[model samples]
Each structure stands twice: as structure tokens, then as C-alpha cells.
Target: MNGSGKDDKQRNRVIAKNEAERQTTGDIRVSAWTIVFAIIVGAIAVYIVWAWLHR
Candidate 1:
């Protein structure tokens, strides 16, 4: 038999890997601002409760 089938399979694998890598290169899967906003909201909640308990 010939080796074209094996070469085709290898090329397909390389193309798929490159595509997956490209998709994630510029993608912000997690936003830093979202995390910061959540932290700020949590701190505000804690401070409000602390002030209420002491006042």
C-alpha cells in the first residue's frame, strides 16, 4: 500500500491543533474586570454588615 493515507491523517491533526490554538490566543475566557467587580461588591457587603453590627 501507499503512504498517502498516513500523511493525510498527520496533516489533518496538525491543522486541527493550529485552529484550536488560534481560537484561544486572543480569547478572554475570564475577564479581569468581572473578577474585580465581584471583589468590590463583596467588600461593600462585608463593610455594610460590620457597620450595622457595631452601630
Candidate 2:
């Protein structure tokens, strides 16, 4: 009974660690995408402004 309990605890720990890692990776992916989107939008805005001013 004691050995079974220890095994359960170990399994739970592994699952929890996996979940935390997945969450962290998801957050990083979202942040990276946001940064990419911001850069693209900024470039477009600059281009529009330049074209308007020059023309």
C-alpha cells in the first residue's frame, strides 16, 4: 500500500510538471506572435505615412 501511494505521487508530479511546461510554452508562442504582428503593422503604418507625405 505504501509503495502504491508513492507511485501515485510520483505520477502526479510528472503530470503537473508537464502541464506547467505546456503552459509556459503556450505563453511564449503567444508573445512571439504578438511581437511579429506589431512589427508588421508598424511597417505598414510607416509606409502609408511616407507615401502620403511624399505624394
Candidate 3:
């Protein structure tokens, strides 16, 4: 019974680790896309301002 309990605990730990790693990867991907979007928006805003000033 003790050996079975140990195996269960080890299995649970491995599952938890995999889940955490998956979440971390997802978060990084989202962060990268967010940065790209922000950069595009900023570029558009700058161009608009420049055109207005020139006109």
C-alpha cells in the first residue's frame, strides 16, 4: 500500500509539471502577439500625426 501511494504521488507531480509548462508556453505566445500588435498600432498613430503636421 505504501509503494502504491508513492507511485501515485510521483505520477501526480509529473502531470502537474507538464500542465505548468504548457501554460507557460501559451503565456509567452500571447505576450509576443500583444507586443507585435502594439507596435503596429504605434506605427499607424505616428504616421497619422506626421501626415497631419505636414498638411
- C-alpha lDDT values of all predictions: 0.86, 0.99, 0.99
Instruction: Write down the worst ten-residue block by lDDT for model 2.
Output: 1-10
Q: Estimate each model's TM-score.
A: 0.48, 0.85, 0.92
CA error at residue 41 for candidate 1, angstroms:
0.4
Query: Per-residue lDDT of 1-55 in model 3, one digit per residue for the tens?
Result: 6999999999999999999999999999999999999999999999999999999
> Per-residue alpha-carbon lDDT of model 2 for 1-55, expressed as tens digits?
6999999999999999999999999999999999999999999999999999999
In order, what is each prediction's RMSD in angstroms? Answer: 3.9, 1.4, 1.0
Superposed Cα deviation of residue 46, candidate 2 (Å): 0.6
How many steric overlaps does candidate 3 have? Answer: 0
Residue 37, candidate 1: alpha-carbon lDDT: 89
How many clashes show up per model? 0, 0, 0
The TM-score ranking, best first, is 3, 2, 1
Candidate topping TM-score: 3
Check candidate 1 and list the clashing pairs. none
